[model samples]
Structures are given as C-alpha cells and as structure tokens.
Target: MDAAQHISIYSSGNRQPDYSPLQSTLDRLKKRTEENKVTINHTNTVVMHFCTSSQAVAHPQLSVGAHSLQLVQSTRLLGVTVDDRLSWKQHVINIVRTASYKLYMLRRLKSLGTPAKELRDVYTAFTLPTLMYASPAWSSSLTLTQQQQVERTQKRACRIILGPAYDGYDNALTILSLPRLSERHREALGKFGRGLLCHPCHQHFLPPDAPPPRCATRHINKLVPIRAPKTDRYKNSAIPSIVHMINSV
Candidate 1:
C-alpha cells in the first residue's frame, strides 16, 4: 500500500457543528482513489468511529464511491480497540479478557504439575507481553478498577511461578524480580522518553539543554517538554507521562 494514500483526520470537542470540511475531504479522497485505479467494495462495510467525551454529535451523511460508510461506536485500529470516549476502557477490557483465558490455560498446566521454571517462562512469553503490549500509550488512562484487574492477572502468574509458599503478592513479585504493574508503566514511559531524546525526529519538539562540559567525552542529557495546561486526559497521554517521568529522574 502507498503510505501517502492513507489519510487520517482528527477533530476535537463536541462544540464544532460543521461537517462540510470533512465531507469535502472524503469526496476528494474518493475521486483520487478512483484515479489511482482503487476500486471500492460496496458490499463491504466501512466503519467511521467518532470519538468523543460526551454524547455523540450528529455526523454528516458520508459516502465513498457508491458506498456509504456507517458511524460505529468503536473500532479496531492497528490492533487496539478504540472506543468513542477515548478512555481506553474497551481496550483494557479486551486485553484482560484475553489474559484471563491465557491464565486459565496456565492454571491448567500448573495442575498438571508443570515445572515452576517452565510455567514462569510460559507466563513471561505469553501473558506479560499481552499485558504490556503498547501499555505506555494506554496505561495512564486506566481507571483504578481497570489497573487492579490487570495487576491481578500478573499477581496470579507470580503466585503460580513462586509456588504456594509466598505469603503476600508483594513477596511473590519481589522473588520474581518484577515491579508492580503501575511502576512498570512508569518505567516504560521513562524509557520511551529516553528513546525520544535519543531520536533525531523528536528533537524538534523536545526542549533544548545547555552545552556539554569540555572534559566530558560523552554526556547524556535528558530533554523533556514542559507540561502544558491540564485539559483532556486522553489527548497526548504518552508524551505528558513521558515528560513527568523524565522530570522526576
């Protein structure tokens, strides 16, 4: 697929009542796609998920090459399920559902007298990845209940791997050399911040720092953006969390 052919538009707030611009843009895209010999599959449904904080606004009737796209409550984008609210609740729920099923399989294996090392390996290979996949992007938005739900999955995995002797969840995690889910989320955000500092593409947005000392052969300078005024939580979550973590260090 030609990367340039894929276009995405983001509109914010419920106050804007105009839809003329969006309709016009879609019309141009439809015409361009036709020029590029792209055929629209009218039989298939195209979903347009409108994300909002409150009740949905009225969407203008939209059609592309004889196919009218339907507005949906939620949709999957690049493997993550994004809902209308942008709360990430749906994504978290879906991950928990998947992790719970995986835990069931792990518990069954445990009953079969599987070795602790092997079970730990399985949990690390499967369950942890599921819980932590793209977590830095969504973890900050999770509610207390949702965070607990995700944490419980890991706690269970730790218990299974550490055997029945460990008395507390903390102890089990300590023995496993693992941090709590929340702490891990912060760590991931910190790492992401450092990665951005090291990348040339992000240098434009990152605040500049003083020049390195003359004696210092190598200087590691951490650059983080100043926090903007608080507004909507879901908007630009990753960068702000990254900034917070970087400033703390």
Candidate 2:
C-alpha cells in the first residue's frame, strides 16, 4: 500500500489538562463528519495513548459522543507497535521476534542445499524488509539494545547463508556483501529525506529554499530545516532529523 494509506491520528491529547481543547477538537470533527454526511461507527471505540515518564498523573476518561474511548499504554499503528513512551522498544522487539522466525525458515532452506545467492535473495525478500520496515522513521530513536536486537537478526541470516564456518558477524556479512544494519538504516534515512522533496504532498514540510549553490553541480533542491522539539523523546524519530541533515548538506 502507498504510505498515505497508513496515516493515523487522534483528535487531541487525552490528558486531563487537554480535556477542554480535546472537547473543542472533537466537536469540530463531529461537525465536519455530520456536514459531509460521513458515518462513524460508534461500535469501534477510540484508543488513547499517553507517553509520560510519570506514573503519578492518572489518565482521564474521554468520550466522543456516547462512546467512551479506552486508554492504552501502547497500540499498533500501521505495522509498528507504538508504546506511549515513544521508546519503540516494543516495536523493535516485535519485529525482531518476527524476523527470527523467518530466520528459522531460512536455515531450513539452507539445509536443503539452497545456493548462497538464492538464500540471500530469499532472505532479502522475506526477512530483511521485516527488520528494516519503516526503519528510517524509527531507527534514530532506538536504544543500543534495540539496535543490537535488529543487527542480531541480520547477523543470524548471514550465518545461515554462509554456514557455521563463517560464524563471525563481520565475516558472514562480508561473504554476503551486506553492510552493517546501522549503515543500511543511515542510508534509508538519507533516501527518505530526498524522497520528501520529490513528493508534492510533503513539500509543505520542507523549509525555505537554500541560498544559491556555489557550483552548478550542487543545484539540486534542498529540504527545509526544522528544529527538534525540546520535549520529544523521539527527537530524531521522524522527519526533523532527516530534513535537518539534508538542509545542512
């Protein structure tokens, strides 16, 4: 599916302090739906996620019309599991667990005497995407443990394809001609930033034009810069860091 198909949002924050503004936002949404003759299934209740370090503040109950939404600590959006804290630990763990299972299948294929090239192709097709899916959007926020978890999966795949003899992570990867997981993630972020400038829908997110390039070769368009939000835990989790780097270049 296209990226736009996976977009998700909430009317407003679910915290007590946000109740007044949330109510107003909901009212506007309700009005727009009514005016557009759109139907909302009240049976499908809203789920709220609040990312907070403090456990002292209780989350207040919220409602849209008669439907009372459930407050959740984490929820799945698109294919990623997002925890309220934005740590992405759960998402990383989930993807790694899934990729591990695929690794087992790859091992079985290796036992069947699958050629190294075919095994590599199968791993790239089935397993690599799972570990790196939407990674550019989340990789920068990953803790070292999470990063290791992802890298371990790739390392295992490389071992499976190259056999137990080349068990060293670097050796297996070298035989496979695969870069480190961190390098792949960095490249993905760079490509994502470039893509933003190519897509019309994301143009508004770009900053103002850069000053004229010093050379004709550097005349390619540049992304606008956005300062990272001071309070955001996933400070570089999404667009800002990518755009920041692009603009700096």
lDDT of each: 0.71, 0.74
Residue by residue across 1-249, what tens digits does model 1's lDDT show? Answer: 743333455544455567666668777877887898886554343445464537656665667756787777677666687876667888888988898788876788889998877887888888888888888778877778989988998988887776676579988777767789888887787777676766777644445662222335455454445556466573346766666566566
Q: Report the backbone clash tally of model 2.
A: 1
In order of appearance, the predictions have TM-scores of 0.80, 0.80
lDDT of 2 by residue, 1-249 (tens): 322222244543434455656656666776786897765554454555564746454565666776776777777877878876767888988999999988988889989999998999999999999988988779877878889989988987887888856668887787788889899898898888777666667655556563333346847656545655776554566677776667667
Error (Å) of candidate 2 at residue 16 is 5.8
- Candidate RMSDs in order: 3.9, 4.2
User: TM-score of predicted model 2?
Assistant: 0.80
Query: Measured by TM-score, how close is model 1 to the native structure?
Result: 0.80
